[model samples]
Target: MRVELDEERRAQLPPTWQRAFDWAEESLGGRVVAWEAQPRWRPACFFELEREGEILPLYWRGARGEWHRNTRPLEREMHVIEVFERNGISVPTRFGLCEDPPGLILSRIPGRFSLDTATDEAHRRKVLDEYLAQLARIHSIPIEEFEAIGYRRPESPEQSCLGETRGFERSYRATKTRPDPMIEFQLGWCHRNVPKDRPELSFVVCDAGQFMFDDEGLTGLLDFELAYIGDYAADLAALRTRDLTEPIGQLGDAMRRYSELSGREIDFGVIDYHTIRFALINPLSVAGMVTDPLPQANYVQYLAWYVCYGRVGLELMAASTAVELDPPSLPEERPSRRSVAHVHLTELLDPAQAGDDGERAYQLDRMQRTAVYLDRADRYGEALESDDLDDVATLLGRRPSTWQEADAALEELVLSSSPERDPEFIRYFHRRLSREEALLYPVLREQQGIAVPPLE
Candidate 1:
């Protein structure tokens, strides 16, 4: 049982990272005996160490490269975890940081990743209650404690509610390759509707509701890459998004549990606002990746995430503002001349061709999915573009002939519009986003049913 990597996955990591396991072994004064990379967009691995006749299961959590907008340095993450552990928050014991590849080494916490694997409904409720209690403890941590560690304290009520939202918007604008009216609308709407009376702030795991759990209860809260100082409602808003994928127990009941544990009144309005803001993150963080992907980039994952979460943001906006939206009717896909080529490409790149090489198979699966998306586009692309331009024409008082022209005109309108126009903008973007959703429906059907769970 020696640490090793298959040729395909090994080539994907940076040259410097090839020795990351050895570095972790040396750091811990142990021998690396076994390791396997976690199959996700980011680079991370689980490995076991042998030290002084005992074996320790450890994890090396890697950074999401500089390209990612919503990530922190590995050192900062280590410090954050240390603070959380000091404050009695359930977290893995940090071993040290790997400087070469930029990751953290820690004792592996044992548990399943989500509540979706609970033995039964009773088990799910019990684990969820325990998780909500942990969330309350997290929100209750003293602001000064985190402030002492260099987490910025919000100076005003606006900063308390809108600070993270502003940061996300800046990231989106800086990295986006093209005009995105949907993102623009969300930014404008959030800025205009910032909860002015927000007086409370806490150290929030900005990407909250991510933790590991066992039959007994939560093993540890994981992933602090996006932690920040902000309104606690932001964390609750994150749980709503997580509920879409992880099936967290009912949010309304969870809110009651959080309110009881934290001894603070829950503000449904603030949570609603944050839900809209929170949903923007999925699309924004992956915008740069989708537009200019790296060789190892999980292109289809980012594309599905953008289409699915972008639509979720708009739907949340509609519900919050009482806007009723009608899904656009798609014209039957007329197969384009290149349609047969797409079918051929999917067959050529099928994941089954990769055989037992897990990494190769994963990459092929993504390639095949890309072909499927393109096939859908070939069949329906023209009709969808026509629908989009028509919607833009309705908003801007003139039709734009091309997708680029439509995006430019619609984004211009979004920037200059007032909050009073939010309903119309939400409706327009909702219909527009639904088309993308429909195109990627085969690969991402589960995400389509995601609705913002009621807070009250």
Candidate 2:
């Protein structure tokens, strides 16, 4: 196959790439017959190089700083992958690297993408199970051997959890373009709930979409840049985040299969928590990415899917007996000046106090400020409630003597605040509601009410 390189893509290539390409051709004894830059979001280009009668896929990234092809860390990782492949582990066939600028040449794996090309539920499950099996094998490798192969683990559990929490916080903080108390609260929750005693760690493929498949149904992992010796749950979490459509039952089945095959009893509880954490991490990370210079439409779609899936994961985690994680206690819930300031305006607009005009006006102003705070916290329900209250206050400010108007206002609030619709919002609206009550009863009642015919 002749690789075609267009002028535009060639122009996009870094100035040092020509030298690197020449080096690769000479070093590998390949004829540079044809090459085209593959479309990708990353700062790398893919090319097809024909060498000694066989065509091969090649990739190269431009060096940003002092790091070059001969750099210790990058070369060390490449060598680790090479070693893994030599040991009969399935990996991409590495031809070699061009030392000048440090580009990699490897034989592309031939298989369809597991995500895009799996045709049926059975096939998808098989692929996912296979992926998990591979992960198990990787994780089962000795920690010392993994470290010898250049995998580095976090120094401490607190450091590892804190690092994960920090990444989530940084992403969310950056994307929303403002500080969020809810996000902070969630981060604190995750940190506090970090599991203890599940210390099994090994090298894991960390990049979001590292697993790739070709037309032939074989899967190969890619992007070992973020590979590290870490908690096994992190990898499972990444897989959950990547494969959002895969049911928790299927994941459990995969764990069973992996354990049976690898002779290691996997902790389903740890994976379950990490999977939910991964889902929660997605919205923040992708949101941050979209704010970058090259905002990708595909990434936006990925973020949307992840957010929806993450919400589902959140509900499932809440329902699951396995997910025992809980957030840290708030600094203060008492009715301090700050807590009072945080009250929603709608709550202040009680119909019982409609006769007290002076108090109503004062409360409305306070509610407006509270709305601002709730909005910052991503507490949309509370924010909207405040807005509704403000609307009622406006109505009352027009005519203070109208008792019917006040009653109508209260009814509107009640109808709008009903748990029948937007159960997720209702939970946030009324934090006292249990998860079971918030999710199940309202849905069941709504369905039941529809099924039973009303008296004419």
Candidate 3:
């Protein structure tokens, strides 16, 4: 049966074709075809083509540049796809880049997305686990051999971590809605706590929604456009962001499986942090697409999950009270476990301070410690005897001289601490405060006039 394109959809096509029927007929190798707009994807038109005996399906991504674009990154992605294909991986086989508007052509795989249809609980669990294992296999591919093939390593873990934190700060400031204090506090805490490091890197299939499975089994992972040599945990974080219905236990199970299969210890902490960051960042990308009333319902549900999961992850990190684990001990000295003590101190003081909440907490903690040292030096026996002097100093340092000063400082910090204005500096400030708290805080707090309150 020949497929007839709707009038509205046909109108969107270029005038090279006289009619909707002709457009489908011409596009499908001169054969009669049945076509319809893919459900839930209004921009792309899908056609099922049939000739004498062969049948094929082609998806035409509409010429909307915003949703789909031919860019350097995309071109790089296609190159990686070719590499994976050579390795006997079953991804969408590229027919060729479309000549008309230059979109990539791919051999359509046969299978419905697990997300698109309901499955039994057992099947869902199995499918989820299988997909994660598949992800592990994809990540296991060595990128060093492919380096000459235009494979670029993503920014180091430290750089990417700082970038994400900075990105969130920028987005939060730009949002029309009043920023959430809790989120701001958490970001500050993370900034003050998480360390900068470059660990092992791996290839990631940036978007996992393109993963396809057939009744036979997992068919293939798709969409390598975001593929890069980066922290594998970051890719896993992206996967966890999409999980709405399952409990953390299930996600943990998948992570455990990946670890077992890959022989690489999965850093659950890093995964958790990056997952929260993913949740925090995704809303901006999907906001415009979520405007329609019908779609907004689904988007709201997704958004709610991301927000909740993000908060949960943050709380877990906060409660854990240690940001980075101890690195392997050297022959001379054992690796030190970095404490969130400064982060805790910062949280305690931020409600009152004028600077970056994370920085303020760090500085306050440093000043208090210094004040303790200074008090000891000055022979203030009473202050030195007090175990709570650090707390007092932090609190005192945060209090405004007047209500007006507090308000002004808060406004300035909120305005100036955004990523766009000072991404590198903001990241540097946070990184410095996180790793070198004892060094950075004393000077910072002295500048703020952080003083020890008199003991009653």
Global lDDT of each model? 0.80, 0.49, 0.48
Q: Kindly list the per-residue Cα lDDT of model 3 for residues 287-390, writing each as its tens digit.
A: 33333323212333333333344434443343344443221111221122322444344355443464433323443543344333332223322332231223
User: How does candidate 1 score on lDDT?
Assistant: 0.80
Model 3 TM: 0.55
Which residue window of length 10 is worst by lDDT in model 3? 447-456
Which residue ranges in model 1 land beyond 4 Å of their true spot? 1-17, 65-72
Compose the digit string of candidate 2's lDDT tens values, residues 1-456: 123555564455456656767687677776554454433233345666776678776655433222234445456557767756754556777667656665555666556454545666666666666666666777666667667765556777655533354555664665565332223333444555667665556665654335555434445766565566666667755654554432223445655676687676667666666665555565455555434423222332333333354444445445443333332122211233344444555455443564433333434433343344343333233333343344345433543234345445434543344333233322232232122122222122112111111111
Score residue 130 of candidate 3 by CA lDDT.
69
Task: Give the higher-lDDT candidate: 1 or 2.
Answer: 1
Native RMSD of candidate 2 (Å): 16.9
Clashing pairs in 2: 3-35, 111-213, 111-214, 111-215, 112-213, 112-214, 112-215, 113-213
Over 1-456, each residue of candidate 1 has an lDDT whose tens digit, in order, gives 234545565566556555786687677887766676565677677887789999889888877843233334667778888888888889889999776666788889999977889989998888888878888988888988888877898888888887566676787778778887777777777777888888888889888888888888778888887788888988988898888988887788888788998898888888888887788888777888877988778787888888788888888778877789988998897998899999999899988887766656878887788888899999998888888888888888999878888888888888887788888888888888888878887767457566776665
Clashing pairs in 1: none
Per-model TM-score versus the true fold:
0.93, 0.57, 0.55
Backbone clash count, each prediction separately: 0, 8, 2
